[model samples]
Target: MARRRDLHPEEQALWQAVASTVTPNIRHRAKTVLPAAQPAISPVDPPPVPPKLPAFRLGEKLPPKSVRPAESPLRMDAKTHARMTRGKLAPEARIDLHGMTLAEAHGELIHFILGAQEQGHRLVLVITGKGKPGREDDHLHRQGGVLRQQVPHWLRLPPLGLAVQQVAEAHLRHGGSGACYVYLRRR
Candidate 1:
C-alpha cells in the first residue's frame, strides 16, 4: 500500500539509508560555478567575397550571349583564362542537363564535347542545375543532381577527356556552381 500520511520513524530511517546508498542521476547533478579568469572567444571574420549580383527588373530583356573569339585551340594564358572564368568570355556553346537520368546525360555529354571539338569550338558551357537541394531518402524518393557529380569523371576518363583541355565551375552569371566550363581542345 502507498502512504499519503507521514512516514513512521522506523520507515523514515530505512528510506534515508536506501537513498544514500544509490548513485545520483547525471542529469540531476548540482550546477558548478566557473572561475572568472578565462576570456570569451569572438565570432570569426568572413573571408573576401566576390562582387554581388546586379539588381533585376521585371520583364527586362537581356542582351544576346556574345560569342568570344572561339576559333583558337585551348592553350589559354592565365589572364585569358581568368577572363573566361569571370563570365567575361561568354560560352561559344552550351547544354543543360537539368532533368536527366545518369545514362542519358553521359551519352549527351560525350556527343556534345566531341562535336564541339570537331566544330572547332574552344570554350563550351555545361549547365547542370544544382540538383534538388537536400539529401534524399527512400521515403521521399527524391534525387540530387547525379549528373553534376558524374560529368567531371566522364570528362576525365575516355573519349571525352581526349578533347577536353580543362573543366572548371562556371561563373555566377553563367550558372555559378550549377554549371561547368568545358574548355575543349582543338581537333
Candidate 2:
C-alpha cells in the first residue's frame, strides 16, 4: 500500500483541536511514594522467585477457527446501484458505529445485519465515521479510520457475509465519506 502524505502543520493543529474536543476525559490518581526499605532474608531461604507463565506443550491443540463465508461476487443490477448512488431508495434501518472499538463495531455490525436480514429488509445504512486524520509518524502504518477500513472486511466474514448481498458508499446527503449502504440478501 502507498503511504499517505503528511498533514500540513495548520491541518494537524486543527485535527488535534477537533480530536481533543471529542475524546472523553480520564481522571488519574496521583502517585504515592514510599520510603525504600531493605528486604529481610534468612540465609537458608531460597531467593524470592518470580511467577512462571504457563507453558504450551508440543502438539497442544488450539481453539477452532470461526467459520467464514466464501467471498461471492456482489449481486446488484446497474439500476439498483444507480438508485442507491442517487439516494433514491430509503434504508430500512441505520447503524452508527462511531467511537466504537473494532471488535465492538464488528459485533454490532453482525448483529445489525443479521437482524435486518431476518426482518426481510433489503437496504440499510451503516455509519463508520471517517477516522481521525493521520499524523506524520503514522505515514507508513495503518493510521486512523480503523472502523472505516475494517467494516467492509467484517461484512465479508462469517454470518454477516452470508446475509449481505451488496455494499456501496452512501450519497453525500446520507454521510458521504463516513457511511455506506448495505443491501441484505432476502431471507
Candidate 3:
C-alpha cells in the first residue's frame, strides 16, 4: 500500500498536466456566474427630442373686456317660454299662429304687423299655439300651454324686428306666459 514504485510514469505525467490546466478554466468558469451582463440602460432614447409647448399667460382680459358685448337679450328661459304667452296685454292686438306651417305663420305675422302699423296699432299678440300639443311621453300636454318657445326667435329677425319697437312675454292675465305681445313703434 505504501510502495512508490506502484505509480505508473505515464499516469503521473497525465495527472499532473490535467490538475494544472483544469484550474485556470475552472476559475474562469466560476468568475462568469452570471452570463456576461448587458450595458447599463440610459433614461432617454438616442437623439430626436420633441419641442416644448408654450406656457399659459396670466391675467389676460377675456373676449368681453376687449370688445363690448350685447346685453341680456332674452327675457325668459326655454321651458318658461310656453307659459309667458297667455298673459295680460296693454291694449296690443295679438295674433295666434300656433301649429301653422312656418311659411304660413311667417307670412301672416309679417302681413299682420304691417297692417297693424298702417292702422296705428302699437301692441299686438302672436299666439303660435305650442307645438303639436306635446308628445305622449313628454307629459307637457296636461299643462295646456301656449307656443312660447318659437316666438322669440321669430321676433329677433331683422326683417321682423324692423316692424316692432319692443317685444316681450305677456302676463298670465293676458295670455299667462305662453304667448308674446309685440309692441310696434307707431311708424
Candidate 4:
C-alpha cells in the first residue's frame, strides 16, 4: 500500500478550524491527573468509603401502612388560583410524560417531584398527554386518560407524596387538559 502524504499548511489550517467548531463528545471520560505530592497518611490506612445512598427502584411498592392516606387535592385561595390561572406564577421546571408507559411515567414523576423539592422549587409542570379519545364501545365503558387519572394517585403515594404540596390543571397556554402543574413543598 502507498503511504499517505501529509496535508498542505492551508488544508491543515482548514481542518483545524473545522475540528474546533465541532462539539467534542461530552460522554468521553477525561484523563485523570495525579498530584506530585503524596498525602502524609500512613500507607497502611485505607481511604474512607462514603455512605451509600438509598436507591430508588421502579415499581417497588411501599407498605400500605407506611404510606399516608392520599391527601385531599390541594385547593388554593381564589387569589392564588386566579394568579395561577392567569399565568402569573410560572413553573420553575417542567417534565413531559408523553409517550411513556404508566410505570415509566410513575418512576419519572417520583424522581422529578423529589428533585424539584430538594432544589427548593415551589412549582413545576408535568405534562401527561391527554390520551387518545375513548372509542365508543359499551355505553358504560369509556377508556383512555390513564396518565391523567394515575398521576394524581402517584403524587399521593409514599415518597413523592411527601414532596408535593399541590397539583392543579395547567392553564390553556401551558397545555390545558394535557398537563398539570405540580407545586412542590419547600425542603
lDDT of 3 at 35: 17
TM-score of each: 0.56, 0.58, 0.44, 0.56
Model 2, 13-88: lDDT tens digits are 6755764565332243333332233222222334577986334457865322311111234478878877887999
Stretches of candidate 4 exceeding 4 Å from the true structure: 1-78, 137-144
Model 2: clashing residue pairs? none
lDDT of 3 by residue, 1-187 (tens): 7844444667656655655565344323333221123222223234566885333346632212111011225444444334433442355476777667667877888888888988998667766554445554443332343234435556667677677666665565655445556767657
Better of 2 and 4 by TM-score: 2
lDDT per residue for candidate 1 within 1-187, as digits (tens), equals 9955656668766765765576654555554332233223233345578986434457855422322223224565778688987889889999998788888988999988898888999989998877764442321212335666667778878988789887877888998877889888878
The candidate with the higher lDDT, 2 or 3, is: 2
Question: Sorted by TM-score, highest first, which candidate order results?
Answer: 2, 1, 4, 3
Residue pairs clashing in model 4 are none
TM-score for candidate 4, please give it: 0.56
Q: How high is the lDDT of residue 51 in model 3?
A: 82
Q: Write the per-residue lDDT of candidate 4 for residues 33-104, one digit (tens) a residue.
A: 322242222223345789863333577543222111123444556776667767788889999998888899
Off by over 4 Å in 2: 1-74, 139-144
lDDT of 1: 0.71
Error of 2 at 49 (Å): 63
